[model samples]
Target: MKTQVAIIGAGPAGMFLAHMLRTEGIDSVVLERRDRDYVEGRVRAGVLEQIAVDVMRKLGLADRLDREGLVHGGTNLSLDGEIFHIDMEKLTGGSTVTVYGQQEVMFDLFEAAGPRGVNIVWNADNVSLHGLDSDKPSVRWTEEGAQKELQCDFVVGCDGFHGVSRQSIPDTVLRNFERVYPFGWLGILADVPPCNDELIYANHERGFALASMRSPTRSRYYIQCALDDRLEDWSDDRVWDEVCLRLGPTAAAKVVRGPSFEKSIAPLRSFVAEPMRWGRLFLAGDAAHIVPPTGAKGLNLAVSDVTYLSEALVEHYRERSAAGLDNYSARALARVWKAERFSWWFTSITHRFPNMDGFDRRIQMAELDYIRGSENAQRVLAENYVGLPLD
Candidate 1:
């Protein structure tokens, strides 16, 4: 097969790119190692920054999102059981975030793919890139015991962190920065009403806890845990008990206990692979960078990455300009690093390190207290939390 672009991975980045390219009259194919069911069912963060919501609407994919997604004008932060609200909308001149699950976004994208003529190859195996440094690049993968090759002008790798996209870049050309947190988050999804209308990030002596939701009726909650914690180590009752204790009495009073349908432990990490573009092969989403879920920037970052990428590609095709393409890395990284800093800062103050001394605890408290008392501090938090404007 031959096309203008061969996009690897049918995840958000790739699929979003495909739809964007299609709307621009560019031809592309998306290759994925998993089937649609598996891809759409994966659990991911539910927060959508303004940029993401705008992208969805621009692509004509926000009908359901507009109807179902919860828009939050503010968020709550808690320090040792005391909660304070940050008026994000008012602070940022009406900017807000939408609580729409990634799963729902994928479903909308995939559902619209066929009618919109976005081509995708599911269950593709051993996907690999070739001739990335050349003007013409190609991708190859195995499908149902058969070999296939796609020749394209450019190949985009949105396959994520563990996928082959990042690995395809030579070691000499890539520089990595990473921080793997000592703890993980024990998250659960239950069929119960959320305790709060807006999301809450909590800091307690025990650890950090997040009270979130996928919908009005489906609550999602998480608490920091040991890296080695197991599913068997936490029962529904125990999880609820710990969540309530950490979130404190005021919020916990509204918590509704129910059987959790999904539970998992995810290690926290901040990672970034520099120089997103490698010749004709470009990387986006988790393939390029990763932020801890503390600030809910992972998917939104991917959206921004591809948003820049798609614009670059459009300029190359429409205006015959390579300036955007050439500057893509530097431009995207500028914003990526800012988000990295915010996520790191947010996590640092909210989570408990293994060796944290009294001074460290006091410092965290002081920082929270400052934000609580100062409108300037709250505005800074609100600005970062709702996401910075795209450059």
Candidate 2:
């Protein structure tokens, strides 16, 4: 098969890229290793920055999101039974975040892109990338025990961290930066009412606990723990007890019980692969970088990367100039690093360290206090939380 661009991975980044390109009269084919059901059902980041919401709205993909997604004007930070709210709109000059899951976003995009005649090849296991240095780079794959080759002018690798796209780059030209935190988050989704109206980020001597909900009837929560921790060891009773302990006394509210899902742990890490381009192939979304879930920047950052990448690809097709495509790495990196810093800062402040010294603990407390006490500090958090302007 031949097309103007070959997009690997049917996740949000690749799907959105294809949607945008088609709008510009460009043709692209999306290849995915997973089936449609799995891609649309995977539960991931739910928070959308103002910039992300606006982009989706402008693209006509926000109908369902605007109707079903919850809009939060602010979030609460609690420490030792004391709560402080960061008014996002007041501090960020009218910016707000929307609570819409990544799965829902992908579903919406898939629906929108399908009718536009975008070709999606599911269960296509990518074998290799060939002819990257040439004008036409090809993707070799197999689907249903049959080999196939997709030839295109440019290839986009949006397959994410574990995919083969990143490996295609020569080691000498690639620069990798990574940091693996000492802890992970044990996340659980329960069929019970949320503990609070707004998301509560709590810091306690035991560890960090986040009170988040997907809907009025379903609640999602997380607790910091070892990377190798297993869920089988922690029963439902133990999970609730730990959540209550870190969250403090229920007071007017109470912890509701329901069928609790198995706990899953995600190790904290921040990673970035330099250039984001090798020859005619370009990387987007998780294929480029990853941030811990603390700041809720993962999905939003992926959206931003594809937004810039699609625009650049369109410009390259129009002007026959490589300038836009050439600058993709530098442009995307600026926002990526900003998010990395924010995620790290938020995680460090909320999670207790195993080797945390007295001075370090005190400093973290002081920083939190300053954020709650000082307008400038609050604004800093608000701006980063709502999102930096997307160019």
Candidate 3:
């Protein structure tokens, strides 16, 4: 097969980029190691930044999102039991975030791909890139024990951190920066209403807890846990008890306990692979960077990466310009680093570090106290939380 671009992994980043390119009359094929059911079933980010929402709408994919997404103008923060609100909408001049799950976003993208003619190869095995340094780059993979090759002008790695895309770049050309947190997030999805209309991030004496939702009736909750904590150690009742204790009186009073359908623990990390582009291969989404879910920037950052990438590809095809392509890495990294800083800062202030001393705890509290008391601090938080502009 031959195409203009070969996109690895059919996750949000690759699928969204495929759709964007399709709308531009650009031809591309998406290769996935898993089926659609697996990709769409992955439990992921539940918040949509303004940029993501805009991209979905721009691609004519936000009909369901617009109808079902919960629009939040502000978010709540708790320093121990004292809860405070940050008016994000007012602080950011009417910018707001939508509570739409990443799973739902994938559903919309996949559903539209067929009618829109976005080609995808599912269950591709041993996917690898070849000749990325040359103008005629190609991708190879095995499908059902059959060998297949795709000749394309360029290859894009959206296959995520563990995938072969980033590793395809030479070790001498790549530099990595990473921080793996000592703790993980023990989360549960239950069929009950959320304790709060807007998300509440709590920093308690015990640990950090987040009260979030996938929908009005489906509550998603999480609390910090040991890095090696086992799922068997946490029963529904015990998890609820810990969540309530950490959330404190006000928010916990509204908490509704129910049977949890999904439960898992995810470790936290901040990672970035520099020079997103190497020769004819480009990287986007989890393939290039990862942010702790604290600030909900992972998927949004991917949207921004593809947004820049699609633009660069469009310029190359439409205007015959290499300038945008040359500048893609620097442009995407500028935004990626800012988001990395925000997610890191937010996690630091909200999560308990294993080595934190008395002074560290006190400083964390002081930062939260300052944000609660100062409009300037709230504005800064709101600006980064809603997401910075593409410029």
Candidate 3: 10-residue stretch with minimal lDDT: 78-87
Clashing residue pairs in candidate 2 are none
Candidate 1, residues 1-391: lDDT per residue as tens digits?
Answer: 8999999999999999999999999999999999999999999989999999999999999999999999999999999889999999999999999999999999999999999999999999999899999987899999999999999999999999999998999999999999999999999999999999999899999999999999999999999999999899899999999999999999999999999999999999999999998899888999999999999999999899999999999999999999999999998999999999999999999999999999999999999999999999999999999999998
lDDT score of residue 229 within candidate 2: 86
Against the unseen true structure, what C-alpha lDDT does each candidate score? 0.95, 0.87, 0.97
> Could you give the C-alpha RMSD of every candidate to the true structure, in order shown?
0.6, 1.4, 0.5
Q: What's each prediction's clash count?
A: 0, 0, 0
Question: What is the TM-score (0 to 1) of candidate 3?
Answer: 1.00
List the candidates' TM-scores in order. 0.99, 0.97, 1.00
Residue pairs in clash, model 3? none
Clashes in model 1: which pairs? none
Model 3 bad stretches (over 4 Å): none
